[model samples]
Target chain A: MSQSVNDLRVTRSQRFIREALIDLIEERGFDALSVGEITARAMVSRATFYRHYRDKYDLVEQIYAEAMQALFGAIAVQETVHSPQIWVTFFDHVAEYDRLYGALLGEKGSPWFVRKMRTSLINLIKEFGRAAPQWQSDSAHPISLYPAEDDLIPDVIATMFVEAITWWLEHGKPFPPQEMARRGVALVGAIFKETSTW
Target chain B: MSQSVNDLRVTRSQRFIREALIDLIEERGFDALSVGEITARAMVSRATFYRHYRDKYDLVEQIYAEAMQALFGAIAVQETVHSPQIWVTFFDHVAEYDRLYGALLGEKGSPWFVRKMRTSLINLIKEFGRAAPQWQSDSAHPISLYPAEDDLIPDVIATMFVEAITWWLEHGKPFPPQEMARRGVALVGAIFKETSTW
Candidate 1:
């Protein structure tokens, strides 16, 4: 067989395995699942599974790493003005993997995944701070001016965004990503408005 | 022994058992924990453990139930005006159980616990809406006036609060409950102010 044909076959098998893992996790959660079940669901042999990945943990880590990279890439390329459209781009990235996000962030989801995702989000917020100094200067008092006691502001804001995103995904995305992004910008502005009063 | 002595003994044992469970959960994630380790940590026998509760699940459920009941009680008795003092009172109640809150809301925490707590918080926010129509009315527009597409405002606010509380507890609470409460109220106000702009 030609090299291209082999690559196509490899891609197809991996897609099947990935989808099967996501569906199983959504149904029975990650811990109760097994490689045997994953292979069976994917209709691929255990030999094929072993050939591609080390184990479930390896597979999931790879998947999450890729998804997070895509998410950050989506955010990084946006305009530095910190507009609602940037939020739209972020949510749109999440929308592309809503099923994986829902399975990983649901009640049956892993705490490890949540922590990893939250750290990425916190970094994204910090990146926003770097990309747009005016974002802070726009406030009456810059975030840095707040006493050290209130240094958790970035964390607070990040957690808020994480929880809101979890809420949005868990609730089936009731509003379009664009609408959620619009509301997100407004909410951040409001949070800053309140913070400045201190 | 007198009846009063027996009651005191029972109270002490239960407290020890509860504290042991929290500490153990913090050390090791909940699912990996066992009744034997819990009793061993509490320095109590398995016989004593069974006398008070059915199993680990029963013990955790009872602990959470009591904690949540106390939390609602704290929120319920607050002044209906939704002042920063009310948030202080709420954080005070959480501070009283900061250990358990930390364990349950931490990276090793249970997702079930997070969901249960978030629901309770959402209910608390809804209660506030009913208790203080003036709270909503104080804004240029009432919460109910938002289009259905944006009806997730309450949920967004509740999640923000939960995430903030989790951050506070996880980070050793750099500020007093009063300070965190003050920040919380301001954040909520900002969210509402932005929502009203819609």
Candidate 2:
């Protein structure tokens, strides 16, 4: 237990560094920034930064991995597989970090930023698939013919959701995060109509 | 007429370069590549490569942009608002380019690729929103109560779809493209419950 607490502390410190780097990258393009700049802006020693990452690129991966883990965890907790409330939970999750996500992912219009977001999202989707294996096989009444061996359904939904968020952020974050989540759930539901066993 | 032909030539050359790059990146890794190496592998002159793009990154952006354009165009044609066929079309479009996409995006596992994919997907979702304004205002049903103004429905769906494709690619392209599309459409349909409209 003590060792676990120490591990948690190390993880927290690493997250702090990554979040600070994301903040800096949002302020200035990733290409225009440097390792020293990130360390300085993050207020961590260069030694510490290197100890955690080989370079800015590697740090970007770590940041992405961390963010994805949190996002997936939230999604998993809210995983209803076919419930409207699942969306409600998702909206709540997005609302909590709209500002940070809006800036880092919605803005910055950089190739690197976009790339990181996609990889993280993909990772999250795979987790979702694993979590909801029955989703592909439980075709009951109205939702019959669930493709038991394909991954297409998840791909389309995931792509659509990310695109909507990007649109919201790029268009100046016109709506509240909850609203965004609600609408997202609705749209997803619309695209993938629900069915009951009866 | 001459100018159009010239434009075609330019487009073809660009496609060739991108295709070659995708192949090379798959065999090795992006980090192990350089402009000279890429140009050499593509069998194009360095001068021609520079004329088309400033560097390898520029070429990457070009590929991303073109791929996105293709994807959006395919979606626009479907205009399903609430149909399984729409999902089918989307799956077909993505599966067609499985090799190139799987290598650069699904398998490469690069942050840069992820960012590019996200940005492209988001742009496509925005296009979908613009094209399907009805989706923004339809509240006759309980699912529509979220109000498009504050919703992130499009983003969530887009993100899911893209991620699913990435998952498919990484997991060995298990299902036939059309079967994959059918499953995707059905899954999303159940989730959204928009069957009455269709």
Candidate 3:
């Protein structure tokens, strides 16, 4: 096969493994899953599975990280300012991978996944801080002044948002994506407005 | 022996196992630590350990539940209103079990423990809602107007709070307990405020 064809085959293999991993996890769970099952579902050999991914956790992380990039990339286009719509859009994107998120971040999900997501989110928030006027400027900054004990502005904000998503997933997504987006934005706002001392 | 002396023996046995579990978790981490080690450290037989706890996880959950009670109980006495101090006081209480929490909720923690903590916390938040006027009053209830979609008000709040503590523990308790309390209350407020349209 030509180089391009080989590259295409590699991409297809990766997608197959990732999708199989997702389906298996959603069906059974992340913890009880095995490589043989993933390979069987993907219609690939164990060697192919090993070549495409390091392990089940790595597969989960790969899917999660990609989904997050797309979700945030779409939102970042219109997110010059933080809006309630960001929650709406971000969650709507998540709902696209509903079962995947549920399996990886739910009651039986791993902390490794949460840790990866939080770190990714914190970076996004920091980028937002630099670009946004309110976060960037001394005068407009909302909660950046109390540097003695609260310099981790992005960490707190990212954690609050990520936890909100985790809670939404665990509770069966009680509200639709749009409503979740609305509640989510409000929830983030409440964290900011209710207690100023921190 | 008298009834009092029998009760004393039971108490002593329980303390030995609980303390041993904590010490072992702190010294190493929860996942690798075993029943054999816990028994050895506490100077109890495996049968005795089994008598008081179903497994290592049961022992961990028992400790967590007890800690939460003491933490919340202390706060409730001064908590006619839910103040930011509750966050401060709660984290301060958590500090007492620093290593155990690290083992159970940190990077090396288990999803089983997290699921248990989340469920317990959701209950606490529900209880808080029933008692708090803002959450109780039909007209005043923040998210309760849409009963079908919003029954999980306390669940989300409790999750956000729990996750924040998890992050704090993972990050080596950077802000100290009091400041953690303050930031925690603020983070919760922000969640409530920003996405109010929902």
> lDDT winner among the candidates?
1
lDDT of 1 by residue, B23-76 (tens): 888999776788999989999888889998998878978998998788778777
RMSD of each: 4.4, 7.3, 5.2
Write model 3 residue lDDT over A72-123, tens digit each, in one string: 6788788444555665777888778777777777655665676677787777
- Comparison by DockQ, 1 against 3, better one: 1
lDDT ranking from best candidate downward? 1, 3, 2
Docking class of 3: acceptable
TM-score of chain B of 1: 0.79
What clash count goes with each model? Answer: 0, 58, 23
**Predicted candidate 1, C-alpha RMSD:** 4.4
In candidate 3, position A21 carries an lDDT of 77
DockQ by candidate, in order:
0.50, 0.38, 0.36
Query: Compared with the true structure, what per-residue lDDT tens digits does model 3 show for residues B59-110?
Result: 8777887888887688777745454555566688778877767778765677
- Candidate 1 local lDDT, residue B97: 90
Angstrom error at residue A50, model 3: 2.1
Q: What is the interface RMSD of candidate 1, in Å?
A: 2.3
lDDT over C-alpha atoms for residue B110 of model 2: 55
List per-prediction Cα lDDT, in the order shown. 0.75, 0.61, 0.67
